[model samples]
Target: MTTVQQSFPVPPQVLWNALPAGVTAIGGQGPFYDAQRGYVTCRTGMTFFSWGQVVTAMVSPAAQGSTITVQTALKFGVFDWGEGKRLGTRFATAVAYAAGTAALT
Candidate 1:
């Protein structure tokens, strides 16, 4: 498992709207967004080094704007060899871009 969190200078709704695009950027599908619950999940295809991964993003309100915590877990494996971390970072970065806001310091 791996997790990456990013803060953006935008509302939670703005970040939520970018969840789908973020999933796509990481070669995943179906963001399965739950606005009321403030969470999203995606299913990634199998890769050469991985069986597959389930990527989830949790959105929360922040004082500055919003914070998104992206987590990636393998479908079947004890270790992902950094693949999960990479995917989580990719998803978070894509969401920041799609939200039209840079990451907060």
Candidate 2:
């Protein structure tokens, strides 16, 4: 089990909207926000693993900006752990890209 955490300052809606679209194809989609929880899915590639699940919890907001924290737990069944790590890395890259895109808009 590995835990990855990141925190940055950005407008709430900017981060939220950018995040879902970033994770669209690689087993990530359908990001919904609710009063209690935020729901999203992440899938690892077949090369390394079959599937991956990432459940994110929306955190509190800052005065000037907001923070979105995602905690991902990888479960690789009959798959290479390296693949899972790569997927995680890709996800992070996507998040960073989202942030950058939001800044541009």
Best by lDDT: 1
For model 2 the local lDDT of residue 56 reads 50
Query: Measured by C-alpha RMSD in angstroms, how accurate is candidate 2?
Result: 4.7
Cα lDDT of model 2 by residue, 1-105, tens digit: 443344556666656665664465346645555644443445443332545655453534666466555545554465346554555455555765777732221
Name the lDDT value of residue 104 in candidate 1.
Answer: 84
lDDT of 1 by residue, 55-89 (tens): 99999999999999998999998889899989988
Residue 92 miss distance in model 1 (angstroms): 0.8
Task: Specify the poorest-scoring 10-residue window by lDDT in model 2.
Answer: 39-48
Quote each prediction's TM-score. 0.94, 0.56
Backbone-clash count (model 2): 0
Tell how far residue 57 is off in model 2, in angstroms.
6.6
Task: Report per-prediction Cα RMSD to one decimal.
Answer: 1.0, 4.7
In candidate 1, residue 12 scores what lDDT?
A: 91
